[model samples]
Target: MTTLTKNKVNDLIMSQIPSFGSFQTLREEGLAFLKEKGLPAMKEEEYKFTAISKKLEQSISDFSPAGKVVLNAETVKSHLFEGFDGDIIVFNNGHFDSELSSFQDQSYELNQLSESSPENLGKIAKIEKDPFVALNTAAFEDGIYIKVGRNKQVEKPIYLLFFNQANQGQIITPRILIEAEDNAEVTFLESSISLDEEAYFCNMVTEVKVAQNAHVHYNRLQHENKKAVTVNNFETDIHRDATFTSVVVSLEGDMLRNNLTLNLLDSGCEGNMYGLYLLDGKTHVDNHTNVDHTKPHAESNELYKGILADSSRAVFNGKIFVRQDAQKTNAFQQNNNILLSENATINTKPQLEIWADDVKCSHGCTTGQLDEEALFYLQARGIGKIQAKGLLLYAFAGEVLEHIANESFRKHIDALVQTRLGSSF
Candidate 1:
């Protein structure tokens, strides 16, 4: 492994100067924090299993911001959802592509990051500890601001399509802020993709605020080119009695690190997070998620599954923190991985830090191969070996996939999973 120092990361951050308008101070703080901690080193507690700093250094050593790539509707026609009817917002190369977006709804508003109010822009996304958030806040080229008005329910899911269509190596930072007003309800589906097998870095941050009693269901699908590297952070603040759910599906990438956090700021909130990573080749995926229970009577549930093949690797670090005042809190976490190849690697840790007496919390992790007995039984019952293995793996991953509320989207994911495993049945 190459030695990637903190100074080199900080130098890269400083080289790409940001032009933050009203949020300059926020960016400055992120720069300072990045300089202090640098990128996550392998020796760090949270990053011990994955050498993220090295991956980032290699991907972004000659990083430069790419110019606008001309994309028309026909270019992305094959990538769009076939039968889904929704408002689609497109971001090309980390910048909002208004010409490509098909959003004309009056109930919701989408604007550039610089157009948002200074007082509200940096309130929900605090960058005190995470340098990545600070870096995104300071250097993001362009992003989307989505606001669902009070008491309104969006009839259809709003789709955020982020496309990295580049032919060279560069770094792209995309920032997003979403706010759902009190009593509002919305569904969001976000997908990140790279059209070509080009080496690039996509650093993205999405901050969401769910107001009192608001309900949100967010689906994140990452299927970037295998030659690309992606670092994504998702932070959400749930208000009183609000419900927030996130389902992340990782299909392809060379190296990916996802940091997902949910903060229960008010009482009686519910947070649910689920993820599935199907990896092969030399792909590496790291998912670090945290749920903070700061209020009483909040409940949270988490489940993540991984299917690794060849020499791929997967890392999962899930933490649940119930503060002193978070009484009557209920939290549960489970991570399960199935390795199809002997060389596949998985590191999973489930952590619980609870100071509340009345809380019921539990965490567990399991990593192993498929059940040989079951495979043998299926094979003896006239099923082909490969088919039996595929069936077992499908059933194993279906637990997390079943949580998807959208039937169509769930089927789409199921198809992708089946294709990945070469399962014809």
Candidate 2:
């Protein structure tokens, strides 16, 4: 193990301190926290699979920071929105790009969090226990803050486009905050892309708050370059009778890690999460999710599927916690993976901690290769081996893709999947 010098670590932490000027207490507290805890080591259970401490030690002194990035209207038209028409928020190198975004609707307010009053920072500071959240709170330069008024239903989806165009070895931190008022309904689509071959580090945090009876649909697509590394944290708060649905699709990147946490603060809430990953080469993808049922009569369901080929590795760790008072809670979780090569690997763990006797909770996980009988049957029908394998893989992924309510978006993702599979299909 490489040793990280104290000065190097302090330098990285110091670079992140300027963004938290408004919250003086949090700023000081976070700095002290980092000084105490420092970078997460391999001993940390949450980071066991993807050992980042070594990477930090090797590159700490040579770390690069994102520089200015420019985008034009035509570029935005072609890359940001493309086919969808809605309120769009674009960020380049983690800074708001107002010139490339569109927000003409009246029912919604899209603004930069940095331009808002210092009071609003406290809203995100409330969840500072998470280390990544604290890091984002300290380092975030600019982000989109979208709020839908009460009793209003957005007719179009709110799109967020994040682009990374920094020099090689640049590191960027992007933050997002979304709030849906009571009885309001909205959809959010976030896409992350890269323009060049840079070894970048993206530490992003998204905080979502859903008011009573509100509905929110959130989807995230990650297609960054294989030379980049990303660590994303999603924290959500659901009120009484609210509904939250989240879909995550990851297709490219050298190493990617996502942490999703849902807090059921009130009763009668519904939460659903789905994820699909197609990994090849030496890629590493890890998804860690936690669903907390703090109140009664809440429902939570999760399904994650992975297709691993080559020597890639995937990890899924899901935990469902039912508090003692959370009686009558209904929770289900399933993780399935298909290994296409002998060396391809998957580590799946589903845990349920139920303190309430009246709750109904179950969890299961499965990892295996393709069935020989099914392959033989397809081959016997005159289908080529590669085409048959692609078909089988598509069918496995279709289970989650079928849940996409948007027809065009579903078709777009389907096309992306086919393209990734090469000429096999």
Candidate 3:
């Protein structure tokens, strides 16, 4: 760390003396760890492919406080789904903005962390060796906590929208916690966008807990700018007879890293994750997912696909662990990528560690260009080269998009995918 930047970071760290009252201990530990470890170097094994410490110093040169209403309803309305009706929770510069948000459903509990103290706030997403997680824990601004009652079904989908307008290069950390009680069902839609083209850094962490016989559908749309850098850490735990599904779409960004971890705590649990990233220009996107099958009769399915264009780069590392006691477990993972330009780069690793003799597990990865035979067939049928390529690319991306269950949200994502491919092709 340079003298100037180190001083800035140290000043920020010292400013967080009386952090959240109940979270003081966690914050102190996080601050101490961050001061000792600083940031991950480029030589680190996990962050070798995607380096962000230098990028953070470059993009986030200074710090500023942000709690103002930087966006109006009209500007915010343009980002919402055209015809979708749901609860809209808006956060400006990482703090909840009541004037810009509305919650119509009273069935589920949604409150700011500064107001309510929940038991599972930092349980699943415990601070680990990651510097980004520690930074978020020490200097988090505001957060949201959601809970659903037992056997109750939330009718409307909860939309968590975040807009960053800290024009002077700010580092924003947003925290979220969700709990689905036994036999409960709910859906969450999370998205982030920058109001300006200025550079900024966003560090986010979300933790979820699903009880017995419960179901949770979590979807995230990454709508970032060319100057935006993000690090997302997501952790979830599934109990007996519960199901958890997540779909992540990365459309554009300067540098984005996602660390997703899921653990099956009891038997009869199912976890599914699907991710799609469409990159162009000098964009970079990395996804690391870890699934641990600690109980028997649990199944996990993960499929991540990417289409890289121009000089863009992407990385996918998926690992599944089947413990010795986790018998009769079924786990499948696959990562497929396509490179359109000669300068495009991809590093994919699919891993499986099975200690149970009665388990069935498979993992593999594929990186190549679009199929020539298919392209030739499309062009041979009177289709233009550009149109044919777009069609093929969209079809390749459909495998992950089809996992979106909501009709309106699916169409919304489909439109975004088509527009992205059309421009690139």
Candidate 4:
């Protein structure tokens, strides 16, 4: 791990200036924007519910991260899919580790960021908009660059693994870009693994470009130790006759936030979003998302659910926007939460803003505890309380897991869900 104080993060960026390559101008722009805006404040509407800035300052007086943690291939292998066949890309502390990774397929081509330039690099996820995005743009030393060939379909799903381990603390920024040419089909999964007992922070950004007649599916799994803090920003552009789907599952973390943006740019395009978070202890997870439909005959759907126990907290704020020309658009969004204990809390808001009269849009949110009547019915049948509760919670979470298209991956994720709930219930 690379140790650097938060105060000297800029120095790290400057030191790597020579290796930035085609992203040099973007780094410069990001540096300028960060200088002007600085980090987000609690008073900001977006960060009002999360006091991450304060948490950072309090955790480290100088806001600097130091320390080191190590892991070899054996440890990483243990975390991989058991008896599963797929391509794996490993990232250690936010940088690519080619020696520990393998990609054996002709359906796609890979290039280093310094040697390649994606045409729509900074357009879909503009650094000018978010401070964290700007920081990642300026500080990221290396990341993944993949281009799927036209009309080609990947036989196996690709997995991206991010590992973080620090004794004291460390800040990691990483970037990813995926370009699916016309008529291509692909599925990608992302996982964040935390090893060690120290504090660490990760700010990651991913951008996806789906050309006409192309299909892309991306799923994320975050189950890290309580000392890890995470901020993930995801953006995608859907063109005409294209499709995109993003599913995120959050099981554990100290403080985690997700900012997702989807843009349906042309007619006959579709997008789907699904998320589930189960937490206990003092853990907190927040999600903010936006979907914009700019053309007629476009559709979008979103669903987010959470189960909180103890003093854990969860937040959801989602918006669906339909432009004036986006007539005949079909949009739906919903957020639901279950608080197992009286101390648990949730704040949820789902909204729809439409400038078109002929569009069909709906949004709503709900927060409550497990159904007492259902629980009693199971107990009346001679089932134990813990078993009944597990059955009920698992049923509620199953809705989101059903959206996973890959059967093997879906079953793997289901096992994880069951194990997590089994221990808590």
TM-score leader: 3
lDDT for each residue of candidate 3 in 232-315, tens digit (9 for 90 to 100): 999999999999999999988899999999899999999999999999999999999999999999999999999999999999
lDDT of 4 by residue, 1-425 (tens): 11223444455545544344787888888877766676676787888888777665555333233322465789779888755578888888887788888899889988766668877777888997677788778777767789998999998989898888754445677788999999999999888998765678888889999999899999889988897888898999999999999999999999998999999999999999999999899999999999999999999999999999999999898989999999999999999899989999888878889999998889988898889999999999999999999999999999999988667778888999999888974
lDDT of 1 by residue, 222-270 (tens): 9888888888888899999999999999989899999999999989999
Score residue 330 of candidate 2 by CA lDDT.
99
lDDT of each: 0.84, 0.79, 0.87, 0.84
Pairs of colliding residues, candidate 2: none
Ranking by lDDT: 3, 1, 4, 2
Query: Cα RMSD for candidate 1?
Result: 2.1
Pairs clashing within candidate 1:
none
TM-score of candidate 2 versus the correct structure, residues matched by position: 0.94
- Model 2 residue runs over 4 Å out of place are 1-6, 19-21, 58-65, 80-82, 118-128, 423-425
Winner on TM-score between 3 and 4 is 3
Clashes of each: 0, 0, 0, 2
All predictions: root-mean-square deviation over Cα?
2.1, 2.3, 1.8, 3.1
Q: Give the lowest summed-lDDT range of ten residues in model 1.
A: 1-10
Candidate 2 lDDT (Cα, whole model)? 0.79
